[model samples]
Target: MSSASAQPANEPDNVFRDPAFRHFWFARLCTTIGYQILTVAVGWQMYALTNDAFMLGMVGLVQFLPSIVLLLMSGHVADRFDRRIIVRTCQMVEALIAVAMAVASFSGWITSEYIFLFVALLGGTRAFETPTLQALLPSVVTPRQLPRAVALASSATQAAIIIGPALGGFAYVAGPGVVYTISAVLFSIAALMVFTLKLRQAPQRLTAPVSVKTLFAGFAYIRSNPVLLGAISLDLFAVLLGGATALLPIYAKDILHTGPWGLGLLRSSPAIGALVTALWLARNPLNRRVGRVMFGAVAIFGVATMVFGISTWLPLSMAALVVLGASDMISVVVRSTLVQLDTPDDMRGRVGAVNSVFIGASNQLGEFESGVTAALLGPVGAVLLGGFGTLCVVAAWMKLFPMLTNRDQLHDHSAHGSGKAATAR
Candidate 1:
């Protein structure tokens, strides 16, 4: 029998069988859960305390500033240092921040300013951790297994995102302190799992001394690669304009007339759709029409966002969010796979840093934008405008980056040659 035929239908391939990757997957699940819980808890508490739309947006800004400020240093650190250690150290810092949040909430000292301060610290931890974690993935799995690995990893995270928010919302009924304490415990568990992993990494060989030029190598590399730039930029601008998550708390309370549990359900709805799609992708990975699929998925995301923006009923809003999450997952997997496949191993760390920065801008800066827009236009108007803006971005990107739109098949590196070649010119 052929090797493919010999593999049992019920069993996962060797990628799932790998012990190290399994542990890493579990660690990611735990970490995602912790972070999601923290997000729900903080967002709810911040809105409750200040009742100001802009202040809620400032919450995102505070978390975002640290990552951008340390972007270069973060990439360099991941490249030069032991990545496992870097990830673990960052997790420890996050755990401490969670602890501080718990104490603050319990004492009734958790003002918006204090929440912003703690979240800022958590963002600093994320700045160092994200690139290292991204770079570390290749060490755990073989190149051939990477697509499945990415899918499984994404599924794990989506599962956590689905569960964490609902649990946090219920815990919020008891108090923010309870939700924070759970986050602290989960963070510590994730750290311990990372510590236990025996990663297969090549010895670090720094060929060049650290300098201004060396630090900015990621930017230069990305600039020279139009495919990479186009892919990242598409996601950055589309989501930046389309995101309505920061205003969710307001929607749940004022627009939808839902309580804390309803808020949790709202948060989890997207992840539920994402998790379902992720699991299916893990079993049957995408190989053909990769670029077209990404573009189509993003367009769906924009349409769904508009639907959710206008929705007054809970079920309609939740359904829209579900579609929104499902569409975004396709873009996430494609962009991540492309970035990982194209970059040289030595430069992956720095490239991962650049990727993280783009993500932060889309998510964090996007939240700030939502807040400002909500203040000016009201929540419904802000989200509607964002969704329309996202569609325009997609059209513009299609015209500007024809390479991305015309591209076929994701697994083939040769298809990306035009983008890379365009960069060198």
Candidate 2:
């Protein structure tokens, strides 16, 4: 996966020209859609079963628990085994789980406990699949196409994020069993595609015995590099503080003088913005001052959050959300490119796993933070404070992580390894 791997003369410049990439991309789309649909269907089923808000919350808890519990071990497994097989296995298992859920739903035997058990199982498989897939991407395409691939991947995810829930909700009308059956089919398709992927060369699987040091090696590697640490942590803090989406319901209903329709628009605005940005970047890759650009994007994210927080007008609020989404996409592309290009082939899984955890923590914890702060300070006050905190984090991070601020190119990461923290080792 080195940058020096020459693209074959017969190879086309476009990422889609590679059959492997096309298969990989389509597979990702299917799995994301299936999982998102599962999420919506499961939430609906859980609430209907228990009629309890706590059980509804438990659905999310069951999913998050697996990532925290298995992340280190899963990272170790990803690095040691063939990533394609790992991903394929996870997909297959998820498909089986979907089948079971479908059967139960149709049989009138699906209980809240049954749903929770399977959901946790699905979450566990994803913990393994996610990091492995991140590691697998560089091998599917050349280093030259990695950034474009990352952008395309982002687009697939964003599109699925929007499509999955909507489709699930629509299909649920036909019956919960119909939604579950569709999910099973989609997961099976993804599993088949993942198994078919051929890496440029066979990976040299790690045969070393497992140990505490080996399990946590990803953290050690990240800590060894300031740029890597900065890029990864910057995202964590920025999103943690600037997350205003959790408060969108309040704004849409109370402040903006609108209804569920307004809330839907508010929610979709940022995702729509992100999807467009991802498509744009896929065609026009970031080639210069990526670090500065990432920071700048984050700064704009903070600003947009603040603007959205205080704005009373619906259009103004939606506008701010769109800008916020666009800026977040830029940072995502930068961080993804940096991680893939900067790390070694063998270590990609471990690094990717740690990266996944940071992302998960930022998202899960950020929502909690928003809820608590919103309760204490009120919705507008919470959002405004979060945005201001994001700006402060940017300033502090710029001064603290000089390596990230001064970083120049995504492809030339290896060339700029003058600092002790330059390479993950």
Candidate 3:
């Protein structure tokens, strides 16, 4: 068995016992909630200033573009630097950006253009921050603890999705400036918490040479590993095809005959389901038959999406969404644990960057895809097709990546190489 399969030895079972992991978790929580709040505040402010629906779309585009444009560089930087410091530095930068936004907003000098520029900067910092933070996790807790750690960490994000926007909405009553101020304070706390962390890392990772080969090394390494490629791409395609979230506003309004309050429940349902499921997994993990479970979970996700699509009743729609979210959480935990434990620590950053790209692309593109499809096919038709398409993706993945389909345990197959050896290929 590989070290990834290493059961708890002397280390405690509760991940929070390790003060390092505890700090890491809190930092994750703070940043996730802070970012969520900031996102709501910024979008609201931009719309308030311009009163243009088109500008709202640009806000997302400006934020998302940086992650794609800087993917290769960000990955390499994560592998070459002190990841803890990288994470802390990025958070601090975000805090300053938030503060600047608050000042500009309160001063009544902020423009939609300025807001776009600020978010673009925020996106760039996050491009560095996300992958470095992912790579930093295994160092925070022992290998045996990583599965639980990922689950717990996921729970934090889900909880934040529920908490942040609602809090931001309430704060927006005071004005977007108040929301920005709150986010800045949260980002500062996250940075300080990250600063307090002490990682038990492997040997110092050497800086890879800055060449075309090194720049694309993460992409190359993932391609060479079929299991890794399968897991990551499965997530990409599943979310791409099946995400009905973009059509939720339509579903709430046109199909369900509901208003803003109904839309809120529809949106909250998935996050609530995901949070509960993540907490459950944190307490009781699924180590055995991981690949099969992942496939089943995704299949459930597809089914739930279809159920949500066809349902006319509000309660049924929300229930399907809850199932959709819980199932996706299971797949995410499995995929995240597999990706982290299977990759070499030296290459984790670069690989994580690629993973982030896929994730970001899936989300942004998924919403776009849903919109295009909805326009062509009615919203119900669009969602149903997405659900069915997700199922097709699952079937295709199982056939194309039998190694992934046949995987027995989450932690059993890892035998990673050094960065030098990995890059040499």
Candidate 4:
């Protein structure tokens, strides 16, 4: 039997079967679900308290700003220390923040200001956690399976995105306080799961402590690598313009004319599409013409966003969002796999940190952009313009970053089992 045919149909044989990867995946899912639930609860609390659109925008800005500021330092810490320990510590901090939010909510002390503070704290943790997690994944799986592993991870996260908000909305109707308490419990459980994982320690460099020199080295690496720089920039610019998540409440309230339940569905539509695509990728890894596929997918995402912006019908908007989600997932998987496949192990943390900065900037900056645009042009105009802008970015990036367009030709150097190639600094 062929290798693919020999695999169990139910199992869909992939790198996910690795015990360590499975443990990591499950832990990630638990934390993500909790975080999503907390997000919805906080948004509900903020809306109930201030009822101001600008304040909502401010909440997102507060979180992203801190994350961008701290991301580089966090990456240095990840490289200088044991990544397993860093991840566990971050997870514990996340659990504590979740607990604190729950307590604040249950005690009738919840306010928009409090939510902002809490979110900022969580964002700080994420700045550290994201780099470490991204850097750590390759350690748990072989290079040949990196793409599959990434797809599985993305799918798991998207699954949480789909389920978490839906659950949060239902919980919110019961009470934001109750939702927060449940989120807290879930976070605690996720932390405990991280604590139980047996992770390999990254070799410590026999060099001076982390300093400005070390920080700049990461930047230098990015500046020197055209392919890496290109992939990162494509994602950064495209998502920075295309992301409309921050303005969803406006759409739900003004455009869709639905309440909290409708808002949840709108929030989840993309995740539903992403989850399905990720599962397919996990089962059938893409090994050919990945670059062309990525470009086409992102262009489709832009078109879908444009369609979504013009649609007033809830179902039609949701359909557009689904396409947007699926196309975005393709871009995400392609870019992420490229990063992992090319990065040296010693530099993974710093590189991942750089990626986090782009991610943080894109998401937070996107929120800021959406808020300002919506304030000036109204929500519909803002979304339509944003989508159109994303299409232009796609074209610009294709011309500017030829490496991304030729991504399929790139090889996974990490698969050769040569520690020298895999761990080169």
TM-score of each predicted structure versus truth: 0.85, 0.95, 0.96, 0.87
Ranking by lDDT: 3, 2, 1, 4
lDDT of 4 by residue, 211-238 (tens): 6767765676666666678778878888
Q: State which candidate has the highest TM-score.
A: 3
Report the Cα lDDT for residue 288, model 3. Answer: 77
Tens digit of lDDT per residue, candidate 1, span 62-144?
88899899999998888888888888888888999999999998998778888988999999999988888888887887655
TM-score of 3: 0.96
Per-residue lDDT over 182-269 for candidate 3, one digit per residue giving the tens place of the 0 to 100 score: 9999999999999999986652474657899888888998898878899999999999999799899999899999999999999999
Superposed model 2: Cα runs more than 4 Å off: 1-12, 413-425
Clashing pairs in 4: none
What is the lDDT, from 0 to 100, of the residue 321 in candidate 4?
A: 92
Q: Cα lDDT of model 2 overall? A: 0.88
CA lDDT scores, all candidates in order: 0.84, 0.88, 0.90, 0.79
Worst 10 contiguous positions by lDDT, candidate 2: 416-425
Give the C-alpha miss distance for residue 368 in model 3, angstroms.
Answer: 0.6
Off by over 4 Å in 1: 1-12, 43-56, 100-116, 172-178, 200-206, 247-263, 371-381, 413-425
Off by over 4 Å in 4: 1-12, 109-114, 199-208, 249-261, 374-380, 414-425
In model 2, which residue pairs have backbone atoms overlapping below 3 Å? none
